[model samples]
Target: MKKLLIIGTMPIILDMNADSSSDSEEEEIGETEETTQKPITCLISHDECYVAPQLLNELYVEIFARVPCSEYWKLQFLNKRFSQLLKSSEIFRMRQKLGLVKPYLFLLSSGANRWTMFDKDFESFLKLPKLSSNICFFNGDKEVTSVGTQLIVIGKEVEGITVWRFELEMQKWVKGPAMITPRVMFGSASHGTNAFFAGGVKIDKNSYEVVSIAEKYNAETKTWTAIHAMHKRRKLCSGFFLRGKFYVLGGQNENDEYLTCAESYNEVTDSWELIPNMLKDMPVLFSQAPPRIAVVNDNLYLLETSLNELHVYDVNANAWKKLGVVPVGAHFTRGWGVAFKSVGDELLVIGASSARPQSQSMTVYKCRPDVEEIVWEECKRCCRGVRLNHFILNCCVMLA
Candidate 1:
């Protein structure tokens, strides 16, 4: 009878089928089978396959670190090992160490409770989780900001000021501490570990009133502390952090007049200093709508959504200079829905294209600032056949 055996440090025996025969005949058959079949050994115990798990893990980390952030979600489903490695911070650390981090554009569209992130490396929009239905009941009027990889959304709900934070690492949204005051059309920005909110419209006696209150939320403590108010009441304004100070720019006052004055707040001194108005040297033809601003290489840029134009502020000169119109094909929804974020030397703008309503496309433009001119280049175009009635509510640039 022919027999088989598995050989290793721990051996296993297997019996083979055989007919009745003499002991000598059975031995002969067993010998024949042994001569024809090699001894089975553990493949993992073989010299060539004897790789350490740590070494294999290191190899996995190195290989996966180069993978584009856009494909991470799909790759996580490959296997348990792959999912574990992808979720490990070690892989992201390796990516950062190897300088593989790239900029990604994240968009929050009004009426769409989910976020759409555009991966420039792959020129694709990644699938994101849907926001909680409870969170979706609120209106789209909100202030968006980012600190590190977290995107903060602040909006006034029926209860009070609701704050939600999206963690890019875990790919989920969590409720943040509620604001002390319920306000809308607020000027907000993220600075270091805290998010600052400035003047905004508050409801008083069923009427809207612009207030001059200022506060900052400490993310670590999950608390909001009142800070010195801005020098002027600002509503429908925008705020940005630069040079260790928070700057509020271009908003309407209680008089419902567009503000030309700008101010910077010093956290250390608890004071505000008036800065040169963005409209100081601009032509009267510029729209009164507050322009979207972004900071690139410590320089400030303003995007006039109506004209699809760009302007740069000279800190030393205290003047704003027009950098001409953005790329010709760029489109905005109702002279709004445009967002600007600085990634390295490029300013990334995201908005809808001028296609028909039923076939509107979401487009991203990369603006390269030069000494003579600002060159706009198309980065990615998606949602080709999908109609997007909702405006681009908020957008921020993230690195991964």
Candidate 2:
């Protein structure tokens, strides 16, 4: 087959099946600097990428790693070298080592055709490529989490349940190497390159079963490894990493009983330590959303859905202290539509703006919860052109 590489209005056709081998890739790049390999300010011609050694593989990886991830799609059509480098995801690994991996926000709104992606500043936005799935996937409840540069979305379609991954460098969606076990309403959290999922409802033909199973996914291998299960079988719980431990909190047990206890997994021992009554003091409302939680500056904060209040978790005391009222209408949908996450050193909350028309715009706020007094400063200039539905269906942050 042939290939057509198009960038903007210009169209360039080339052989897609070309092997395009190079000697520069074989050179050792990780061990030391390539002192003998010379650097060129620019590519002299498109053909030189494969036919000659102009840029060292280390230089290419370092240059691309520093470039904003938003511009990765454009690099795809540059040449065969750029395409292969990105497709291999070597740049992503370098980004981690260089401490250049930055977070990006992805929001799936109610009735939206595509997921909207925003930079950390929230000044600009773009729509991600639509998922290639049946209507069952879009309409059904979805669980989303980000591992490294990939966005993993889990939901049911016509073919039972499936996992779809959105690769950052490729700028497209691909059917996943499915999870170790397919489940719904699972608690998930990402630590560096690995994603943790645990305690969910595993659905089958006739009935659904609540499970205590847990699994960890390695993004580099695109593989899931089964981990030790939680002490209690729960669904609708939430998961987050705090103080180097994976914590699962607040969900319904196998017998449909509301659980206040929490569990933490220790990788050193591969066992779960159950903490009873971790959320006992908080009032449990009917059909409440799974604890809207975020950890900022090593401090865990929970968005109380019933009263739009914020509370900080005292890890030592195992208690929650109310901070103050939030500006959004979190209780409108019982906390389902709001997005709570930690972006860098601050707590970010996005939801229906209580003061204005929620259908036309979302309220964005961020605060450093570690301070003596909490102050949520709203981002008044977020994506003015595209009025987003405040009722966010799901949200995830990708560090790429």
Candidate 3:
């Protein structure tokens, strides 16, 4: 007879075949298996505290202290062991990053879609270039005729001379050629490592013009070439990939007047056609909002400045509704505000305080699709240690 034991206590008796091994041999086999049995252990600590129990808790602290809540939540679900370490100082920070908890919004102003962690509210983690304001980024990718990890940002130093680049991973930004003319506030979308930059403001000392010229940047070649220019010029437009096409939405003209119009660019035809205006019959109600747009659950949301009311519009439905609004003084005036979806269908607004351009604030707002009033709150603790450059909310995964 062979017997297996666990915890050096209870034994599991195994009857060896009578025709097989001797009793002594069977006992040896049982002893070997018993020794190899894995013992159940708690994630926190073990007897005598040979190792510091704070290590796991400290890991919990360090990770959340460094990363955002959305990313941290994903890591937590990687294994049961990680989720157990939720009791730590960084939990609140993670919650703040993820929009799980709230109070003071985090804001850092440099440019949208640049990755940098700040140590103070007004100072930035990245060294600003002489023409940092002239640069903007576009997301791109390769494979599947769709966008991937490619990025595009440009600087217009002198003349209407604009330059763009592609990112290799999130760490590097490779430069490309100057555009035919200098442009800013352009819209760019990706189709597999190639990003199309279109519809920006072209500047040439003492005057600026709305432009419709479109250009494409190839990540592999690190080169930018001209594509067809659109018929109309637009500035501060929203560009995104949807249903195999690049959609450009409502933007302002040269006079700073909002235009309730939209257009789509087709790669195959190298043409742009007027699509239905995203906000038809919707009058421009606020000056500060400046046609801010964000996509959530495949539905597009247009935020209005009047009382910070958020209007939800279905591009497919051609319909609209008041989704929610943020409290007054919580957001910056004339700041670039963007929305990011969290791990739990939560929506976060990334913006800088117009009151103070250098200070950035991240507002975590709950989405109430069915309710009349949407609740917006700020995460005080998460932004406590972080000073400037905001929370990397829009550009963390992207290269600046």
Clashes of each: 0, 0, 25
lDDT of 3 by residue, 37-75 (tens): 221112232322222335434433443444433233444
| Best candidate according to lDDT | 2
- Over the stretch 123-187, how does candidate 2's per-residue lDDT look in tens digits? 88988898989999999999999988889999999878899998888899999788888999989
Any idea what lDDT model 2 has? Answer: 0.82
lDDT of each structure? 0.65, 0.82, 0.48
Instruction: For model 2, give the 10-residue run with minimal summed lDDT.
Output: 27-36
List candidate 3 segments past 4 Å from native: 1-151, 158-160, 164-174, 205-207, 254-256, 283-289, 327-346, 352-384, 389-400
Model 3 scores what on Cα lDDT? Answer: 0.48
In candidate 2, the residue pairs with backbone N, CA or C atoms under 3 Å apart (3 or more residues apart, or in different chains) clash, namely: none
Could you give me the TM-score of model 2 versus the true structure?
0.87
Cα deviation at 239, candidate 3, in Å, is 1.7
2 versus 3: better TM-score goes to = 2
Per-residue lDDT value at 369 in model 2: 80
lDDT ranking of the models: 2, 1, 3
> Candidate 2's error at 378, in angstroms?
1.6
Candidates ranked, most accurate by TM-score first: 2, 1, 3
